[model samples]
Target chain A: MSSVSDRMLTSDPVVEVENLVAHYGSHKVLDGVNLTVNAGEIHIIMGGSGSGKSTLLRHLLGLRRVTSGRIRLLGHELDGVHRSELQELRKQIGVSFQGGALLSSMTVGENVTLPLREHTRLDESTMAIMARMKLEVVNLGGFEHFMPAQLSGGMIKRAALARAIVMDPKLLFFDEPSAGLDPVVSAELDELILRLREAMHMSIVVVTHELESAFRIADRMTVLDCGKILISDTADKVRNSANSRVQDLLNRRPRVEELDADAYLARLTGE
Target chain B: MPIWMHGSWMMAETRLGRVEQLGKRTLGLIAEVGYLAALLTESLYWIFAGVFQRQPVRVSSVFAEMMRTGVSAIPIVFLLSFSIGVMLAIQGIHTLRTFGAESQVVIGIALSISREFGPLITGIVVAGRTGSALAARIGTMVVSEEIDALRVMGIQPVRYLVSPVLLAMLVMLPALTIMADFAGLLGGAVYSAMDLGISYAAYADRVISVLKTGDIWQGLIKSAVFATVITLIGVANGFSVTGGAEGVGRATTRSVVLAISGIVIADMVFTWFLNR
Candidate 1:
């Protein structure tokens, strides 16, 4: 496992995005977004709903193609990477989706061990031991055999986290880790994430709207608004930034943009 | 331009737009067909690759799907095929009796069931039953991001999800069709003995004499094609689902409709080719 740490300690950027643009059909969801995540650091991407943070995360993961931009993960540019190369690159990264996304047909233990089974020729016993170790790391040691449907919301998140990190990936991504959890459970998850980063020595990129969790776990935070990055700095610097959009987001203020009556009428009339 | 002329110009432009939309939809349908064919080719490649690489097909998943798509469908297929057989016999009797050839009813029923009705009915039933289920299952997985999750885990969804089900359908649909054929013959026998004043032995002999092994083989071949069409359409529709629950519902409906239509069209082509 120290080999994983050794690999993770490289000075190269774990994730790099430059001038990234993305679209859902004709409408742009990410406009000229740029980000960089360094080794062994927890980078929090924070934004309100529809702020393109998730879209950015998807692009970083190579799950979505960029309309125009560069995404370099672990020194490999993703723009024109072949399918096999992209898959090989993805093997070094792990993503925990917002909904857990564990296969309902498989038990939690099976879900956690799926990557090992697919990518490694390890014996079943070894895979089981590794899966149990990860579950223990996430405080789900004894509940590995439980079905995902039987788990509580907090437990499901923990199980998903265990599955994500079972391969000891160099770069880990979390999508709203604290969503749908109580305050106490959310805090516990935050602690688990921090501990995982320290123990595994991996770079982490978290997409979240939870301000408290963001501030608590982020080594550096990037705030995005309406498809553009407002600020990318240390937590305190981001909180203290002069940008009105950053301040509004941090203070939970409703954004008020004056509507144009003529535009509104034209939209209603399908013009 | 004058106001009246401008209105007419707008109307003409709208008609042109509608035509363009229709053309785009036609092209989209063709693209979808091409995509599905590519997916099928890729799935076959993976299956063979797995075999050569010693990564055997997931036996447990294939067996589970076999039970779901094939074994569990027996009762409904039986009922449907039996009813069709009985109806064909009754109608054949009525038509033949007018010409003093009511005994030919057995030949008509046997030929129709073995060469056409059995596979077609089995396909339609399985399309409604297993095809919709496949679409909904995969659609829900898509909606919940599980497919993306699998991709993130370095597991190709086509290999893990579609291949086993495809293999299962290939194995099972023909098996179900055979069962349907037998049930249909039995139903025809029952109808003939009870009402048509025909003996069971006479009816069986007539069926055996009039029906060739080639007829059964053709029907089985058609079932295999129907199986591929049903599962491919189902999985393709599932993968294409967007939004959420509503998307899953729409995918399920589309899978069933598309599978049934594809099966019938395929049946027509197979019948023509096999008979010729």
Candidate 2:
């Protein structure tokens, strides 16, 4: 399991994006965003609704086509990398979507073992053992046979986490790991994420709008608003920043904007 | 332009807009055909390449699809084939009876069922049943992000999902066609014996004499083509799905409509070739 990532220096960037610009039709979704996640770190990207955090995460996962700039995952530039090469690189990276995305057709155990079956030739017994080990890591022990439909929302998230880490990815990206849950379950997930970083020795990038969870687990935090980075720094610095928009986000204040009569009329008339 | 001239200009603009829409539709169809070809090619590659690899085709998934696409479809195919078979025999008796040749009904039943109705009817049923199901299943997966999960896991969705279902369709559609043929024959036999006063032995002998190896092979061959068209269209429509639950419904409808059309068009071409 030892690889170049293990030997990399602490400051080495595992995930890097520079001047990344993206669009959905005529609307700009991500506007000149720059971000980096160093080796063995938890970098949280936090933003309010429609702030382009999801789109930025999609770009990092190589799931979206960008309009400009560079996205380098572990050293491979994703912009025009060969499909096969991208797939090869994907073996070392994992993603958990906001929805658990567990195949409804399969049981929880089968879901966890899916990546192994597709990509590895490990013996059946070994595969089972490794899947169980991952489930235990996520505190889902002895629930191997349960169906995903049978799991609670929190449990589904944990199960998705188990599947994501089953491959022991060097770079893990999890989307909204605490979006839907009781406060206690959300805290448990926060703790699990911290434990995962400690044990797996991997860089993790989490995308979320949950401020408390973001501050609790992030080694460094990047705050994005309306497709631009407001601040990228440690938790304390980001909170203390003098930026008005960042403060607005932190204090959960309502945004104020002067109305433009002509533009507003055009929008209303569907022009 | 003057106000009076603006009328003709608006008319011309409307005509041009229609043409532009037509052109876009034509291009969209062409792109969908391209998508179908790519999906089939990748599926075939994995099916062949899996021979050297250890169970890359995922036999369990294939069997599950077979149950849905073939085995579970047994009752509907049987009922339709049998009813069509009986109607064909009755009509043959009526037409031939005018010339005192009603006894020849077995030849018509045997030939038509084996050469035409078996594959065509079975294909229509499957396009409605399994084809729509395929689209709905994959469309749901796309909306739910399961497809993305598979992608991020380094597994190609077409390879992991489409290939196994395609293989199942390839194997099971032909088997259902054979069953359809048998059901049709039984229906004809029962009708001829009871209504036309034809003996069971006489009907069986006549059917055996009329049905040729070429007839069975032709039906089987058409079933294979129909199977390919149905799976390709279904999988393509599923991948093209957008939005959410509503998108899945649209994809399902498109898959059924397109696959049924493909079956009929292919059947027409095959019939033309046979006649030639």
Best by TM-score: 2
Q: Local distance difference test, per candidate?
A: 0.90, 0.90
Q: Where does candidate 1 clash, by residue pair?
A: none
**lDDT score, candidate 2:** 0.90
lDDT per residue (tens digit) for residues B108-139 in model 1? 89989999999999999999998999999999
Give the distance in Å from residue A124's predicted Cα in candidate 2 to where it truly belongs: 2.0
Model 2, B1-276: lDDT tens digits are: 998799999999999999999999999989988888888899998898865644378888899889988999999999999998899888988999999988888988999999999999999999999899999999999999998888888887887899988999999999999999999998999899988888888888888888889999999999999999999998888888899999999999999999999999999999999868
The DockQ scores of all candidates, in the order shown, are 0.67, 0.65
Which pairs of residues collide in model 2? none
Estimate, for each residue in A52-97, the C-alpha lDDT of model 1 and write its tens digit.
Answer: 9988988887789889989999899988888778778878898899
What count of clashes does model 1 give? Answer: 0
Error of 2 at A19 (Å): 2.3
Docking class of 1: medium
Q: Which candidate is the best by DockQ?
A: 1
Q: Go through the candidates in order and give the clash count of each.
A: 0, 0
